[model samples]
Target: MRAELFDPRTEAVPAEWDKFLRDEGAPAAWDAGALAAVAWTSLRTVLLGVVADGGQAVALFCGDFGSPRRRNPVYSPVGGPGRPGVYFSRILMGFDEGFLFATHLDHAGRVAARRAFERALKARLGRRCLGVVYQNVSAAALPVMRTAARLCRPVSPNTVLVNRWQSMEEYFAGLPRDRRRRLRRTYADVDADSGLRVGAGVPAVDPVEAARLEQLTRLKHLSPGEVLVPLPSLYFERLNHRDGVRYFVHTDPATGALLSFDLSFEHAAGLVTTVTGSAAGAATGRGLYWDLYLREIEYAIERGVPRLEFGKGLVELKARFGCVTVPQYAVAAPL
Candidate 1:
């Protein structure tokens, strides 16, 4: 098997690359078009594939390499050995979630493809390439991933709320009495605040305001030694027009101010909440965050989406909202 890299920005994404993802039932986030829409200035995105002599794709994955001088530091909790920027030189798989499409291959085939892909990756990046990191790897894919990397360390779990209720009322009815009472009260409080209104639709946000709010949220939650790369307004601007992408915004009706926003993606697998931003000094007692979560949950229920993925972090808090944790790991190999 020989490995090849494709830059969607420079050329058309080979049809076979998307075909493999579709055949494997990958999420919409992995679609070629979606990948191409990613506009982070600090990272270079590429699609990698391992093809056999017969021209059949044996392995496929999406990767992003961080800028050398502008390296982003790893989160303290999951930061591996060495300094904060140890992972800066590595290629990140699938941005936030890791996925390798190679179910069609046998064990030996998977190994060969992985080796070839790694070799090609190192060759492409040369001395600057320290390794490749597969983040948020699920348990089911661990075996296959093990064939490629030596380090498999547990990180935060991906939180998911599986939708079983038919309506918002049903969802509330299923919760425990105390939890249910709290949620009902919270919703009531939010509704009573005539000044606050929440809406969900295509992103119609001012990029400058959105970026400022996003950075504020990041600062509030940032860990020590963690350096986050600032996403330009262009990043949000580019994603605004993508299909299956939606933004839920909390606004002050009287003043017409955007207080907070959450970005979600609708995919065949489920609706995934990817990014969120809240205005500085936003009132926490108003339950704006919970309201956003409820909006997401209600959206999934209305659309008949099977699951609502909340991504990682806040394990206990998400659990209180009936979200189950799916353990995730980082598989890293140094060259």
Candidate 2:
């Protein structure tokens, strides 16, 4: 086995990386299609593990060896303990799953490929920068990541998902009577509120307005000294592409105030809400967050998405909406 490094800034993604990802049934974001969109952006480089047989890549990890930036504890910006090393996810993207492998690889083969990749990364980037971090791993990927890493567990930041529901009605009916009543009232209130409208599209929002909305949203989750990363305006603008990414914007019709927004990605037969924001007062006694969840559920049910992944936060609330809780672990492994 051999490891290969590709600097997206200066090199093209090897065909083997593409072939392996496809063979593994990796998500589109892990493929060249999405990687191409990010390779030129803020990303630093990518690492790949190749089989000895024909130099075909079987394992892949993408990240950057950049300065440590302030990231929320809820989401570590990169892979290490704030040192310069490769972070698996891009700055703009939140944790999906980490470390993609060819589907054909069994447990032993998967572990071997990871070890090989780690050694190559250490040789190329030096021992001080030899740590890999994977975030929001699923049950299927947990064992593989644990094969060569240290796992960190957090309490409330677990990903919540709803599966096996046939329709919105079926989903709503399964909720507790009180929760169901509250959701119905909230939906009605949002509908009747002439000042507010839920607009669906992939439009790029004004940066200033986006910042305002983000700030308001973060207030709900702020710890005393936590600093959240600032998302660039270009990041939102880039979502305008025809890919499965979509945004639902909440706005005030009269004042054009950006009340709230949700960014959802269609991946692996599921709808994942990657990010969301709401103005401080916008959600006051309005149940705006729950409404957003309901909207996502309806969208998923209509589109026949087998599951709706409401990414990490407010577990009890999400559970009340009929979403099962799943523990999300971040694994750190030293090269």
TM-score of each: 0.79, 0.76
C-alpha RMSD in Å of predicted model 1 compared with the true structure: 5.4
Q: Rate the local accuracy (lDDT) of all candidates.
A: 0.68, 0.63
Candidate 2 — which residues are off by over 4 angstroms? 6-57, 63-92, 147-157, 200-208, 254-257
Tens digits of lDDT, candidate 1, 214-333: 888888877666666565665566566666667888888998788988877776778888778888767475788888888888888898999988878788878777999888878877
For candidate 2, report its TM-score.
0.76
Best by lDDT: 1
lDDT (0-100) at residue 67 of candidate 2?
39
lDDT of 2 by residue, 181-234 (tens): 888888788889888888653545555676557656766786777564454444
